[model samples]
Target: MNPFDRRPTYFFGVYHWRERLRRIGASLSLFGAAVVVGRRGGRLRRLLAALVGVTALVRAGTTARRLLSPVPWALDRPKYDALASLLPLGDVDRALDVGCGSGRSLVGLAPHLPSSTHVVGLDVFDDRVILGNGPQLARRNGARAGIDVSPAAGDASRLPFSDDAFDVVTACRVAHDVPETRRDALFDELRRVCAEDGTVGLLELPITPEGVSDHEAYWRRCLGDAGLSVERVATVERPGFSDEPYVAIAATPTA
Candidate 1:
């Protein structure tokens, strides 16, 4: 049976269901507004309205897709291993997962880290945040090892942590999903949460070529400019998309 079928978890489940439904309603309202705007507007206004309509459609579709799919859009399928491979330190004091969908990667790698380490998973999706069993599983397994998984909702671009709070901060398959305009800010937030000498593992889809060369070059340039030293990079063949490979970059924020 579903764990959320119980009392505490059920409360959060109700909240999530309501939130998801509200978002769907809001997205539909936005689409209707765009259509109405287009009917009464000039060419330029119609163009702008069309853009808004498209954006709303995409947003609504993305939401519905996640609701229907087993895995969320951000970390669907073999992407689970994508983040797990990024941890070089193998569990330190505390680790944070940004855009952590369903916390599958956290639970998978929890045992790899020391029992004393704390693993926190963050995601903005209401459903995933409510239902992610990865954190609970990790908590259960790590009880003997003294590890705990705390899941929370957070924005990728605006982290609520002080500078250098986490020993390790990981953003798995998240950069591309974010708007390019906000990617820099999101990146900065990742750096902010990371301990000064700590590490940030970014596992992203390679927009460049498939090999490690392109992967290394892209992250090297972007992360280097952001004051991160590229410690290591490896080419990984993600299971579902074997033809479309991925790269895992491990970097440290400079002083």
Candidate 2:
């Protein structure tokens, strides 16, 4: 694969240098305030300042790392690869990626499916959260990967597709972001669009401290409430970011 070919101009190819610099400056100011509080304030004030300082430092460090190296950004490839492998794609004819940012997951899963398979990615692009033109960037990324993907602007909670429209449906790191009250609606939409025998693959960050405990029950309940049955669950460990573990859940519509 040509590193320069088909790459999205805004997604990974362009760095948000100005935004990162602003964050760095803010973090430095917070650190300076922490030092002043520690020297002249009460014990409680010092403790609060210390907490804020630590958070600021961590944010600055992560932002700096992202700016200095491409490895952190490239990690999405392996993450999507793992997600695609966990889903049943051998005989898939039509697939959809909900909340597909820059079409990375769709492109990554394309190679695993039959050449004739049709893949579509839907996302409600918010300029504040999503960098650049999402649908266009997704198309460019798909072209670079030699996959033909249809990218569209849509919401997960209210998918525009008719019932039983896709053979495989997947979402990466999107469910938890939905408000607690609306999460069920999102899964309900996923179940509605998925064919009876089709699989719904969800990749999410661990919600529990140990990374595997009660989270299983929580997801099972969520899927069940949405009229889906959990088939399998697996935890994927990201190479560079060990503290953040990804959980992939495969579910099927209930009878």
Candidate 3:
């Protein structure tokens, strides 16, 4: 069996269904307008219409591909598996997943740890961020992944947990969601809740090709400022998605 093949039983819902619908709608509108214009236009005008039509078709194709792909969301199996394998989870007694939307990343990491480890997920449960996102959905997904997840409601910048509480803390593609002004606070909070010798794993997706290096550097700096020493940073490719690179970092709180 292919290691990357998705397990038949493990499932995570498609992320942001509404956004996919909106893209499809916009593409159809553009295609329709181009068709109407091309039917009664001069040569130059017809050429412009053809360009628009091609653009619409391309946009629609991209959106359709994403809609059908279960990646960067439904575990993006390889990326999550890499994250799980890279993190030091051997002796972790308690773990926390910040911004655990639908518990996807949490579930991904759970199977890699000992069954005795206590895992908790924290999220704002805002549907605006992900359709059908909430504690109920998270618990259900966790069940599908064969892990019993405990859900909590809270903000990343101000975690509800006390300092040095968790042995392993993780956040996947979460830090980029916080406003730039408050991101420092979020990092600080992540570091605070982590035990002095505990490991913190962060997985992030870079928006642009040009920004990948800068993005990695920025996150490294953020961890440093938060008093965490960087231990490892690995670049993993999301083959199931667009072949984009995912940045995974492992750090430990400084003495």
Best candidate (score: lDDT): 3
lDDT of 3 by residue, 1-255 (tens): 888896535445566777887998899899999999999999999999999999998998899787655553446566677777768887778989999987778777767877677888999988764667889878887777776788999999999999899999999989988888888999999999999889889988875234455777878888999999999888887665556688889999998
Report lDDT (Cα) of residue 219, candidate 3.
Answer: 82
Give lDDT: candidate 1, residue 153: 69
Weakest lDDT window of 10 consecutive positions for candidate 3: 6-15
lDDT of each: 0.68, 0.77, 0.83
lDDT of 1 by residue, 1-255 (tens): 996664211111222444566777799899999999999999999999999999998888877665544333222334445555666556488888887655545644554677677778776754543444343433443343344777666788998778888998888767777776787788788888899879988877776433545654776677777778888776678667776677778889987
Output candidate 3 Cα RMSD: 4.3
TM-score of structure candidate 1: 0.60
Q: Lowest lDDT 10-mer window, candidate 2? A: 7-16
lDDT of candidate model 1 versus the reference: 0.68
TM-score of every candidate relative to the true structure: 0.60, 0.74, 0.79
Error of 1 at 241 (Å): 3.2
lDDT of 2 by residue, 54-84 (tens): 9889988988876645432353566677767
Off by over 4 Å in 3: 1-8, 30-58, 69-73, 207-212, 240-244
Candidate with more favorable, higher lDDT: 1 or 3: 3
Candidate 2 matches the true fold with a TM-score of 0.74
